[model samples]
Target: MAGDTKEGVTLELVTGSAEIFGTDLQLNKKYTFPSGTRTAVFTYQGCTLELIGPTVHAYVSNNTPMAIFANTHAGLEDICRDTENGEASRGFVVLVVGPTDVGKSTLCRILCNYAVRKGRSPIFVDLDVGQNCLTVPGSISAAIVDQLADPVHGFQLEQQISYCFGSTTPTANMPLYELLIRKMAENTAEWMKRSRNACISGMIINTCGYITGEGYKTLLTIAESFEADLVICLEHERLYMDLNRDLPNFVKTLRFPKSSGIEDRSQNVRSYGREAMVQRYFYGTRALPLKPYRIEVPFESVEICQLGAEKLPDSCLPFGVSADDHHTKVVYMKPDMKLQHHLMAVSTAKLISPEVLNHNVFGYVVILEVDLQNHTFALLSPVNELPSKVLIYTEVVFMDDQINL
Candidate 1:
């Protein structure tokens, strides 16, 4: 797994009693051999590994060969292209934002992985006040403050920014993304000073999905602060585009919602098929002919009631809910249940965008049989803000249980 600098020459050490050399034997050179080497071999390295030995013994070790692109300076050039206009010390700043289950943290993990793989320490910062997946679950500020208080800790802090709210003190009403620009700059500067690693030159900030007018404002503020090089809007970007009438196929490729129950329908009951219809009704694109399951009731009783409806259509029960308003407005799940469930808010929140339904911390949707004894419902999203009350009716179906009409 190591690389060599000399073109067309490969160097490798053998663990067994064999010594091999690519160069000619020199009297002045020390012919160091493995302690237990009873044989010697030679090999050539190029696009592939070739083993040449005196005795024929071939075993590939079952190590799967990974396709790795050769390292090129083009990547550095691409990274620098965004920062060329900025100060020499300050590199490009990239921001990553998404909904609760859209894999914001996962994206951060990928970025960190890429950075570490490149022998760099990417200054990471988590601004998800809801889930704080990178930080402590509930204690967002504490987790971040503790890290800053002790930077030399044995724990390998994910080269991240504050994982909690930026404000040091909690207030009844504070500005969204408060202290973000200042904190990001301060912490990044601190890390740069402490660790003189050139790779620690860039910054990445992860944001919460619960972007209120205030939250969105905060995001724009931070972007302005850094004059960011790139803004990677994650999950919500698609929904936003669709609402704004500029949907991209890259976004439409996401899974739609589905029905939550149908495995126990009566012989004449075609609930799953009907749920599929509802999914098609809303999405009207490439919906599958199946329903997604009702995973969980992520919303609190108050939240559910506030949704303004408790019953869905007779056909799309437990998965689709229509507004009582005269608009015949309907909300339904995406066709791919598993993918939607994996990446979206469960149950009712499936219809809502992640930006409006940040439930990773305070609450989230869960799916399970309604009356099944001792069955557990899993959390689907993080609760970041209180939901607005809209006139809506919703219903979910379980094997033997039912929601009242």
Candidate 2:
């Protein structure tokens, strides 16, 4: 069963057993799904649910790709068992790829949940910057999936490492996107060495839906960087064939049809989701609200760096060289009124340089107010103090209700 709740909805398992994103629902207990939530309930055995409240649409269908999902999980489990038995030297890594709205994220969630339920801990790497499950939009993040994800809240944020590409799409800066993916892969490798369970259980990667031109190249980069053992392509036969032809023989590729319940969202709906995600970062959720601190910092105290090369006219370029020569240029900027309402990443780097692009961020802050006269800016941050002296500027902007700084 799948539905879109409008003004929130309540679900009760009337008979049999069922699960949402791999978490079992309690019998006779009510589960409240928040408004604007798109979800589906799955069960191997036939079950009945009583739903209450308004919804955009609701439906029940026996046709689902859940059996394929379960079989894939079983195959991964066998690989893990092989590693544990000393038949393999390292854990297996699975990469899920496909176009947008193809249920790639859903498959990833189901796989992670199944792994956790079987006493395994798999690392979840989210490369989809447009709608990341592990962190806010415009970033690539990874987290250890040690428990089943909540149906409403999704994955729990713990020990998550993220790098802000400063844009929702990789098309903004392909070099920066690829750079972050490499850094994430290196970090994940080191993390796996520390935990035997994590190493044996392996990692599951979720990528963006962009599957043409530069997007295709980005997928290859991710596969090679992470040394992915298996590539699962959903609903895109062309992509599957291209990857099989281009990728090395050591890597196996499989294609699966997309779920019938998948729905394509419009640009406006996607933008709304991104804005809501940013708000949730600082404000928490309805169930657990958080108080974000607003602090005024001197402009001279920290350095702000922006990624991307400076655009120059073709006439100024030498010979056949193009403007895309310097894709990783780090330009420093002074605070001004234009910075207001934009999000800035608090870099782990102590100084502004090109190396900052390779480092993971401490967190993010919104520029609430920029005072040119006082040479100080007001920031709305989740923490009281900025952890680093360097900040990276991003193209993502957020505007909340007006507040006195």
Best by lDDT: 2
Local error of candidate 1 at 284, Å? 47
Candidate 1's residue-wise lDDT over 1-405, tens digit each? 111222222223333221121122222222322111122232223122233222223333222111111121124334544344443544445666544445444444444444444455556665554334443321132111112111101113423333223121212123323443444555555664565443234655666665555656666665555445556565465534432342223221222221111122232233333232223322222211222333343333222211112344566544443333212222333222232221122222333432221222222222322222333323222232323311122232112122121
Clashes of each: 42, 0
lDDT of each: 0.34, 0.87
lDDT per residue for candidate 2 within 339-369, as digits (tens), equals 8988899999989987887789988999988
Number of the predicted model whose TM-score against the real structure is largest: 2
